[model samples]
Target: MRRTLDRLYDGALWLAAVTFALIAALVLVQILGRLADRAARAMDLPPPGITIPSLAEFGAFLFAGAVFLGLAGTLQAGGHVRVKLLVRALPEAPARWLGAVVSAAAAALAGFATWSSALQALDSLRFNSVSYGVVPIPLAIPQGVMTLGLALLAVALVDSAVTLARGGTPAYRASEARTEADTEASTGESA
Candidate 1:
């Protein structure tokens, strides 16, 4: 189960990376197309008018998808900003409990977000909503991706809460510990 969950998070992260790469590739192509037109004009030839239809809209949608898809992976990787002063100050037992409580609360919020996003996706699907662009991209597609990302994030937070409640170090905490150890090793410090 643990391995499966880790793979799921990793897969989402990979997909997010691919999505961003696609965006970059598309932008590069668009830029190249513009340069081609410019070169043609400089040569006293007719311009090719090679412009990406609704490039801005496509970029925006892909950007949104990438951001949403990265949420769970970022949480698992300890990339999310957390105020750890209180947790670090407390005794081990109290700190564990506090972490569990906080994780649970965050999981609840993520769950709510997942629900709301799913609803929005469904509504868009029902209405057959499309973006106001040269290419009629379905609004539901991006909304559905957002919903999936929120669902994964909620699962990750719940996993953290459960692990903490069971007196185990959650993935994020373990990641942070590894990072701290690496930092200390490099600086010749011990804690």
Candidate 2:
């Protein structure tokens, strides 16, 4: 189960990366289309009419996918912003409790977002809603992707909270420890 969850998280992160790449590709195509049109017009020729339909809308949707899908991977990697100063100020026992509480709250919020997004997606699907743009896109598709990401993030937060409650280090803490160890090793080697 643990291995499966890890794989799922990894897959989500990979999907996010793919979405970002797609956004870049789409933007590039849009730029090239515009440049080609400009050159044709300059040459007193009929404009090639090259254009990426709904490029802005598509880019926006892809950007959102990248962000939402990356959340779980970022948390697991210890890349999410955290207030270390506050955590360090607390006693060890209190710190542990605080960490668990924060994780729980995050899980709750993520779960709510997941549920709401899923419902919205379902509603969109039921209504057969389509985005208004040069290229009509079914709204439910992107919403479903966002919901999946939120669900993955909620699972990660709950796992962290449970690990803390059991007096075990969370994935993010372990990740941080590994990073610090690597940094120290590199510094020692340099010295």
Candidate 3:
């Protein structure tokens, strides 16, 4: 039973990663298209691509989507920058416990927010709310992607907390992988 749920955590993290990449690609396409248009305009020609999105709005959504999806991986890897001074001073067990508790709270809050926002975004899309532009599309469509990222973050957090509570170290935590990779690279060796 626990294992089934555990899959959800890791799976969600993977989902977020893929989603973030997709959002980034979407944003990049929009940017390049605009740049092409600018180059065309300079040459006294029509913009190559027709504008279908409010670049500002879609860009914002892409950012939100990336951040939300990336948070779980960030948290797992201890990439979340915090004041290490205090935690580093504590004994090992205490440090671990404190980290677990804080992470649990953070996960809960983030998950709840994402779930709520997703629902609202869905409703907005249903109401046929279209953005004003040359090619009008519903604002809620892109927001839905952001919502997916946030929801995944929450799932990843819960997975981490549960695994820690069971005395299982999350893959992202202080692991031997970093040192091993460094040693191999230093020795000009392949693993």
Among these predictions, the greatest lDDT belongs to 1
lDDT digits (tens) for residues 151-177 of candidate 3 = 666766776777767677765565435
How do the candidates rank by lDDT, highest first?
1, 2, 3
Tens-place lDDT digits, model 2, residues 1-191:
77987898899999999999999999888888889899999999988887889888899889888899999989999999888888889998889889999999999999999999999999999999989998999999899889988999999999899989889899899999999999999999999
* Candidate 1 ranges beyond 4 A from true positions: 189-191
Query: Each prediction's Cα lDDT score?
Result: 0.94, 0.92, 0.69
List the pairs of residues colliding in candidate 3.
none
Question: lDDT of model 1 at residue 150?
Answer: 94
lDDT: worst 10-residue window of model 1: 182-191
Please write out the lDDT profile of model 1 over residues 1-191, one tens digit for every residue: 89999999999999999999999999998999899999999999998887889899999999999998999999999999999999999999999999999999999999999999999999999999999999999999999999999999999999999999999989998899999999989888653
lDDT of 3: 0.69
Candidate 2 regions with alpha-carbon error over 4 angstroms: 181-191
Lowest lDDT block of 10, candidate 3: 4-13
